[model samples]
Target: MGQRVLFIGLNYAPEHTGIAPYTSGMAQSLAAAGWDVGVVTGLPHYPQWQVHAGYERGHQNRDIINGVPVERVPHPVPGNAGLARRLGMEIMFGLRAARARWNNPDAVVVVSPALFASVIVRLRAKYHGIPVLAWVQDIYTAGLTETGSAGGFATRAMRAVEGRFLRSCEGMVVIHDRFAQYVQRVLGVDPARVHTVRNWTHIGPSTHMDPATLRERFGWPMEDIIVLHTGNMGAKQDLGNVAAAAARADQSGAPVRFVLVGGGRQRPLLEELAAHAPRFEVLPSVDDETYSALLGAADVLLVNERPGLTEMCVPSKLTSYFTAGRPVLAAVEAQSPSAFEVASADAGMRVPPGDPRALLAGALTLHGQWVESGGTRHSGGARYVREVLSRDAATKAFIAALNAVRTKGHAPTRTTTIATLNN
Candidate 1:
């Protein structure tokens, strides 16, 4: 029988937010790459925290999407979830999950952030006597620590479980250097068994709309300097500071406009923070055409994070930012994985995390530079995204590593590691 891989994750499409796009993409691409790939995911519901309109909590759904078999199990979707409620939800998923609805003959790749699902995936692979890989999209405990999502006891318990699941895997794939360091030192995964697979822009190429025309269409002033951030406005994002920076810029009489786009549970908090700041605009997400237009229309693409959010998931928005051909102003920690990615890609400038003054100053400086250079494109990020960090590049590297794991009956060796990075 041909080698088969089963992917387990809580979030998957047709949910439009968070990690769904990437997980769905990976499963489909792996199938296209000639592996027998099947996905076990929860029913579609994500940042909204409610099952999408077509799905019911008690019913199961199955479909073949892009040649990948997907079995969607029903689980409670809490309107507002804390650690306890989230765990209860995972318990429901475990109760409802039948054996992965596929003839899996080889391996499994489990994604996190329905992190409690790890126990089920690990045990299932062990029972089947097949290899398993933990695809560490987010360093679980570190993220909870940064977000203050759980109490100390819960953090420790989650970490212990995560470590056991990771170490039990035949291999692990981490997306960032800081994640790799944390996992190796704290989680005790063998450095040899850990692999780093950098993410690419999951969304397609931008429409490359004319900046002036697009800005005018959106009712934005042609002369003002625009800084736009589009993505989930969760606690870890610290986007309240964007409103703060907008207030600062307005008080200083600078022609700077800050636009925060996208929806999440934190959107209400963001709206409250920006209520008095006229220059700060929090818009409900627009259509894809407008999204592509906004990326091209802005003078700068901005990223902000809460202080003490040192290393967690590398924000997926950076990959999208890199594709827009605009300079990025990253108001993030010096040691954050996002900071590393910005510098490594040579994409844009960085400031200390959660500092509104610095964020304001950085945006103005970037605006001035754009004016000074007569808008000569600072297109390093676009070039890097296309040539170095394209989706095809990530796919090629992952397949090679998967092939190695199948051949060796374990994680790829150092040789495969070097080659994958080169891809």
Candidate 2:
């Protein structure tokens, strides 16, 4: 616990979904595993896209959560974020978050959402003669292009910015194997310095949640088969397919009910789709215990990604889905890293991304299997995740990367500005 581990991110706990949970989990797990952890992040505002009460343009503050120290910097809450709006918010966070000086850490891990914050981390770590690890959750340049935000020249410029800071970092961690490849091959980073650290489920254990109580609360009949998707309803999630699937399932007189629980700009679109579907329901985000309970009570957990998002990220919700002990139905790109991960886990089925028919068929297949087995699909998800993809495994890998970079030595100190961020 002697060495200090600093995590810099725009997202953190109380945000509930997306990279926030993982960032919080990583810092807490690292602390539990005998590292003194610290985090510098912005005020919590996500999923709902509004700042949580009590922290409106709040000044920078410090507190400890689960034995790890956290310093939060205040910034404007960017609701229903567009690329330009998000960029402005992240820039504000990067400047303010970097202003807080703590005792020199042995290493710093920078999380993306504010990807350019890596520059702040790299320069700060260099000043202290420590290593910097870029914990990449998304490839922003490709994300922009895939999401139709930027074009040829803008994409090239963004890529150059990404490449510069990534190459400058002492080490890097990507959440999926494909990400590692992109970092090394596309970003031109040293493959030897890039490591794959898969994200783990964020939902707590289902023990405290009584399935009967939860089902009763939701007013779902025992005969109803629940198919649920839980997480941020962001644009990258091709969730329109889910609503369309729900409508198809309802028309066919299936007893299955589709439930979507979370927040984001796309939520309204999903809600509108749900409205005409006889059995479709959309619930706002719930408390941690209730969320876990919902996961457990669900007969099938769904992972639906919009087309082209495969190049951006692997949905982190799959981890929680696997841990829920329910069979998963991942409607993602056939060759996506998510599809590959689910294939390896043996807990789910993958259909092509953005296909309503495929998503409906997969859900029906899982439902039929469950009914035939007397409601016992006997998921392999829990076991697979426990042995192969636990957060503890990620903690170990992160520590190993830190050690590797520390042993390799740090770059000489120098201020790196965004002007020089483009390689």
Candidate 3:
């Protein structure tokens, strides 16, 4: 029998956006690679922040998804979860995960975003003498800064707590190089233990769909350019800027229809803002087929971030956007990881965040390119996806990292003690 490996994460399959897809993909890929794999995750509820259908708030469910055994625990799904509520949800998940049957797996990979939960799981793993690796999707300290959340005690407490847990991990996997740097530098982790494995496109290849037909079916004008932003409309996403840009386009009579498809805490606010903009449309999340078709049909894919949010995340949508062979327009800080990904792939244009005029101008420029190149111009993104974001490559690298963590027989070497930075 293959070596046993277990994944502990808060998100999993059936929630097809955000971190869930990646976690599910990684877990399944490991299973396919001949490892005995199991997952301990929460009942699906994300982006919408409401419990998924058929999942009760107090029940523990077990199921097999794509051949991987999954054990799910109940966690709070706050309607509009603020920081305290979000933290509470994470803490609850942590407590539940700690109580779940680990079955003495060879190694444990814990996903973070539920930073507090990871700490809890890691502490428990230590008790069992199981090597623990951290799959850090985002840094909580950076999140506090980017979201303009209350700091001081909260920030210091998070940094110290996160630092202690991360440093103690047998290995850490980060999706972007920037994230690795932050983990090593800011979190005081040993550089050698941090691995950079770029996230692959979790969505399958999009089947070809005629743009005109899709636009017609969706009631989008044929003459206008379609600018689509799909995924969470959270505060960090700064979709308010997208709505503002759409309103500007409508007011100026630009032949562009801006569409947002997905849910988040900020969706209601975006709907209100777009109500007066005839060219703007807001749609709920669609099935995978429809989502991929929409990506194929759109003239431009967009990534918008709050002006000051330079870290904490690399938009997972970019991987899908790059694979869709469509031009991308990023409205974000130039130095942010999302901007770097866009620029690195040569996928699309970048405009400063929070500037509706700049976003409108960038979209117009991409529209011009779309017209001039007959829509075959986004080869850069396609090539980058093929070259950099291959599932096989990512899976192999992650498995190697996990194997190292599982096989390492000695204590993790520590470089520096956790620093309590006071701002």
Candidate 4:
């Protein structure tokens, strides 16, 4: 048998969050590569803070997805309220994961999300004497502080906590190159311990449905040009500029129609704005089939990030946009890593965040160019995704990292025997 590897994350299977697909794909790939893989995650309750139907609260349940064993534990989903509730959920998962590790030794554990799971990783490392690979999706402390979501004493406390967590890890994996620099400069993390591995979007262009069929099913006009935004609609997204751009497109008598699909705290506001404007269409988040169809049906995939969010966030959807074979209109800082992808892929245009005029102008220009070019928005992004962001490439890199860590003689934190049962 190959080396046993474990993954710890807040959200996983049955959850349609960002980390779920990435984790599932990685686990499946690792398992197929002849490694013994196990996953530790909380019950699925994301985008909606309620436990998924058919799952009961308990220690955990084991299941196989795509040939890998997954272990799930119960964690509370604080219904979009207090920090204490959210912290409770994080702490509960951390403690349960620690217990699970104590029982199952010999598994190489990696913690994800970089915020709550970092604590679990530290505890497991300390208790089991295991090496942890910290996978950072967001620079949580900086992201929260810069975004004004955290302030004053809270920011200081979180920074100290997260800094310690980063320092405790055997190695760290970051999605963007700048994140490694940020870790070294801001958190004082060791430069040698950090690794930059780009995130992958496993979905490809072949999954796309016919545009006319998608339009007919969605009840959208085939004649109107669709500008689609799919993903979370939280504060970090800053979608007001998208609405403002739609309003501008309407004023110019353009046939462009804006479609905002996804749910978040900002969904209510987006729905309100769309309800008051005929040019805007707001839909709730849909399954992957519908999402792919919508992406295929649209002329452009719009991505937006609030000011200063580019450094803190690496929008995984950008990879999906590339995979969909559509141009992107990204409203993000030019200095962000996203800008590099846009330029490298020649996928689309970038406008300064929060500037409605620039956004409006860019959208109009791109729409016109796409139409003039016979509606060919292809920039070879899909090919780029297949070559660069494919599961094969990402899984190979992941396995290399795991092999490196294993070769270093890293061991699990603790080991205990459990009673064997026969069916």
Q: What do the candidate models score in CA lDDT, each in turn? A: 0.78, 0.80, 0.87, 0.75
- Put down candidate 4 lDDT per residue, 191-291, tens digits, no spaces: 97787777888555545578798888877787777889887777788889889878887888777788888776677878999988777888977777777
Evaluate candidate 2 by giving its C-alpha RMSD to the native, one decimal: 3.9
Q: What value does the lDDT take at residue 8 in candidate 4?
A: 82
Candidate order (lDDT):
3, 2, 1, 4
Model 2 ranges with Cα > 4 A deviation: 374-378, 408-423
**Over the stretch 199-238, how does candidate 1's per-residue lDDT look in tens digits?**
8786555555777887887778988889999888778888
What is the Cα-based TM-score of model 2?
0.92
Model 4 error, position 311 (Å): 1.1
Backbone Cα, N, C clashes tallied per candidate: 0, 1, 0, 1
Each model's TM-score? Answer: 0.90, 0.92, 0.95, 0.91
* lDDT per residue (tens digit) for residues 1-423 in model 3: 588888999999899999999999988888988999999999788878888888887789999999999999988878988999988999999999988877667888999989989989888777656789899998889888777785788888888999999999999999999999998889999998999998999766567667678889999877888999999988888887788888888789888888999999998988887787788888999988888889988889999889987878999999999988889999989889998999889888889999999999999998798679887665588899889999999999998899889876343421111111111
Which structure is stronger by TM-score: 3 or 4? Answer: 3
Q: How many backbone clashes does candidate 4 have?
A: 1
Clashing pairs in 4: 128-413
The runs of at least 3 residues in candidate 3 whose Cα sits more than 4 Å from the true structure, single-residue gaps closed, are 376-378, 409-423
Query: Model 1 off-target regions past 4 Å?
Result: 98-100, 208-210, 375-378, 407-423
Q: Is candidate 1 or candidate 3 better by lDDT?
A: 3
At residue 419, candidate 2 shows an lDDT of 20
Model 2: number of clashes? Answer: 1
Where does candidate 2 have its weakest 10-residue lDDT segment?
A: 414-423
Residue 253 of candidate 1: its Cα lDDT? 91
